[model samples]
Target: MLESFSNININLKFTIENEKNNSISFLDITIKSQNNCFQAGIYRKPTSTDNIVPHDSCHPQVHKTAAIRYFANRTVTYPLDVISKEKEQKWSEGLIQTTNTIGNLLKPKHNNKNDPYKQSGVYQLICPKCDMIYTGQTGRTLNERLKEHFNDFKHIYRKSKYSTQLLGNKHPIGQINEIMDVVYVGNKGSHLNTMEKFYIYKETTKGNQINDKNTVPTNKLFDVVILQ
Candidate 1:
């Protein structure tokens, strides 16, 4: 208590208000300014009955009504970007909740209006020309996984194996514009190989071209890697 008081450079005093029933208690503080001869009074509730003014015989008006009116009329503002982000955060949280509640069958919800990629999950890319599909999984984000495909689409010699095999065939649909649509298959996982294999099997059974032959890679690291 002494340490807290010593940290402050201003002259101040504190008083505690005991709670009644389930209502919460609060502190009433009084401060004296050294810089100017300005006096201020602030409280959550009036500490004394004299602070309240009796106008009507039945009820009384508030004593510090002018201070309340002044603060009420004060202009308040927030950044437009901050407001946009707050709204986006709420939308994302709702999507996360809805995704978790539903099993594998729920269609992929777009993270944004223009983007089909999600923050995390197993996703499938469908061919525009044929009914062929490529299923893949990522522990990171679907955006990161889709980026690898986009990289393959851009390069002549593709770095992503699945991207090359899926897009490099005779009935090739190499461009992102040519691709039909992207859909989330299973939930994101650390070891997504099993889920990817299951979706691949399902799609292959439905007559879709299977690009990946190897389900489990040799000496594969299964841990979810987070990059700082």
Candidate 2:
């Protein structure tokens, strides 16, 4: 049973229209027949608090307006009559105007990301005898990853480029503490890829990068940071 299903967020609801109900509410719209024509209008559950990502919050602008975009999209896409459409528009305008109100404070995300030993982010492994360095990211702890690199280099396995490239150049590979350093801490995913690339780019600019060049398109955001 555990393998077959889980009920974490699977909600069950009865949407069947009863004798007293003329409209069916589905998702964000209400649908019903008027005269001889079928019509649909925006719907909001009574429990809706009209809350969204506030403008004053420490988050990306796009993240703040994502809900607003959805509201505008629904207002344009739904078959609401002029009156209902105007009401939704006014509601959306009010919501946007009130977004400047700050709510509970949240600690800056950097507070957590700065912990080097907590794992998951870009790291650098340097050759003991050369200026070259290998930058990489992993979801696991840096200690574990660095140990893996050391073992791979000692065994002459081809799994890691850091191992093969360093030893191939007749360089000595030391234990994790002697050669590895945590560069930036971040969670796993494509975000790590960008963070890893940023460090690699830095190393390459200094003529010390040992990794192959990446083909990911140039990120304008990275350029803005580097130019400063």
Candidate 2 lDDT, 1-228, residue by residue in tens? 432344443563333454225677777877777788767778889987688887756899999989999999989887898888999999998988763321111111233534565576678888888857888888987777887887888788857878878878888887666787776677798757767777777676667788886623456655544554
* TM-score of decoy 1: 0.37
The deviation in Å at residue 186 for candidate 1 is 7.2
Candidate 1: worst-modelled 10 consecutive residues by lDDT: 219-228
RMSD of 1: 18.8
Question: Per-residue lDDT for 1-228 in model 1, tens only?
Answer: 755775575566544545433234224322334355432223335534222221322343354354334333321221123444455445434433342321222334444554555455567776655656777666666667767776776675576655566557645555443553454533555435555554565565455645565543432112211110
**Cα deviation of 131 in candidate 2 (Å)?**
1.9
Winner by TM-score:
2
Q: Which regions in candidate 2 have their CA more than 4 angstroms from the true location? A: 1-115, 215-220
Q: Which pairs clash inside model 1?
A: none
